[model samples]
Target: MPVERSRRLESYNLADYDRLPQCTNRRRLAAGIATIGPAIAEPIGRRANDRLPFPPSTPVGNIVLKLHQESSGALNTITSYGDGYVAINLERHEGSIIVMPEGAVIEWPVSSFEALAPEHFEALVAAAPEVVIFGSGSRLRFPHPRLTAQLAKHRIGVETMDFGAACRTYNILMSEGRRVAAALLIEA
Candidate 1:
């Protein structure tokens, strides 16, 4: 019988790792870091010990990986299909991993700006749009001034708000077909 493939891989830029085999059934873990290429190999290998609790066959595409480490807690919530599955550190720590297909509609609630890295910020900026809004989780503190200044220089308007409100606003705007993106850091 022939196997069916999803549209997710249709546009995958395998050009970067053309040498990597395309076998879907190959055990991702056994294939080791070599299969994922140099750029993402190390990070993915390091996290192998904490692989997602779900079955390996779970389909993932266009994932949004968020990392959070706080004194209060560490949690990882993977949201997809309008549902979230959470994984937490049992020893009073928290971490989470969320994997969703590209173009999955989501409303994320965030409270802090520190969860995201510089690469994430750069990608958002390069997208270039009329406005860019950030949901700073529940906190009202401003983002690094340098980031704000960079956006201003590009003539893009920036807005910051609490995580819950940001999620609601981003959803509403997206539903209206607006060009928008958000970085939210909600508790697990």
Candidate 2:
């Protein structure tokens, strides 16, 4: 039995050795990295030198620093938002409002999620956003599917969330150049 086990081990060792060359060839092919030459290194070095260590002289750095500055040619940015209000372009607005990324801030006729209806989404459809973010007052609440049926027919997507989360998501989507609208409901 001992001799048979030794023979089995030797066979396993021989099998492993047979695979070594094939494995090395596969690794080399997988890497697929061409030999680096001065052509690529020179352009990379020049581009790196041209870029500033910090952000360029633009309002972009303000956003990273959480400072109240809007980017050039950017749509209205939500600077501050809370339970019953959201600030657009540094202007405080009360009541429900629909914020379009490239358009105006129109007053939404909804006071709360409980008051939501199909008509409430009419303005959003008219605004023609690719996606609609519904901020359900102070908490995450979803309206009946029937209420958002109009949006679905228009091939628009809807995301439901709390007021704070909706505000943050809207800003991110808007900054990414997406056609988005935020239907924020502020319960009195």
Candidate 3:
């Protein structure tokens, strides 16, 4: 009779009572306990196995640029070309720019270029672009007096260059149609 009903359900005592835990037994107990309380809970189970979370920020819109060619080492790699092109990976300690646009990925933290006053040039002239390059990564500087009087009171037309001539003049004025937008500062 099914081996005496599996030896009477394995001799039955299943810890007497307190049941409700099995989601695969709470994934083998070792993530974020919900039960197993008290009894010196082993220093709260060794500080919940030494805490570990942050790893979920990476979602914006079409993006793909991965070029970490051992400039020092640590940018892992992920290249296959997506839309535009601003791929440069050099890490001996740090250097990253992979804004691949096609599905998702926006990692922009260029290393050396910081001079945007006038409340960051009036919030980049209220994000109403028509032309606003400004790589200044490789260095050329010039944009302070209240961000040149708020881009001359919203006449928005600033093009301070360097980061590879401001990424080739914002990709040739976005390929001759114009409506450009770039604010780089790469080199870490």
Candidate 4:
């Protein structure tokens, strides 16, 4: 409804126009476009149909991959997530993983917070992310202080959340160009 916050799409075809509410700012649409819905009569703006859709990889079970846009030396974004996996840049990986900005996805062999060991965190220390998103499966859980003490000594911060929040936060931080990592546990 807000004119300033309309989703700027790369390509808005007749089918796309057919899906919108009539009260929307139809005047903001590109010129020369066909009538989309019964209410859409004329085109509105210029060069609105020349955009390309970003293929954010969606998760399919445990392993899947798709084409994604280059991050321009940025860290990978979490495309989507589900009960047992998070899709990173069109690639769906299972179990636990260490996702870093500027590119490195180290598969961590962890299933749950109860299965975490000090050495599991040691891998993160070696990865040396400035901030870590520790996703404790489907629920909120925290690791032992000793497990993360070494990272604390290095001034590295770790935020604990559920798996879903971890995925979203990871994407936001990566887009911001932050030195962040996601240690996600997507199992019971």
Best candidate, lDDT? 2
Q: Name model 1 segments beyond 4 Å from true.
A: 1-119
lDDT for residue 144 in candidate 2, whole number 0-100: 88
Q: Which regions of candidate 3 fall more than 4 Å away from where they truly are?
A: 1-129, 135-137, 140-142, 145-147, 150-152, 155-162, 179-188
lDDT by residue for model 2 (1-188), tens: 45544333223354564366434443333232232232345555555434423332333222231236557365878989875789998889999998987767888777667778789987688778899998887878888899899899999999999999999999999998998999888888
Q: What is the C-alpha RMSD of each candidate to the true structure, in Å?
A: 17.9, 17.8, 19.5, 12.7
Query: So what's the TM-score on candidate 1?
Result: 0.38
Q: For each candidate, what is the lDDT?
A: 0.46, 0.75, 0.47, 0.72
Task: Please give the lDDT score at residue 143 for candidate 1.
Answer: 76
Error of 2 at 158 (Å): 0.4
> lDDT of candidate 2 vs native?
0.75
lDDT of 2 at 5: 44
lDDT score at residue 120, model 2, on the 0-100 scale: 90
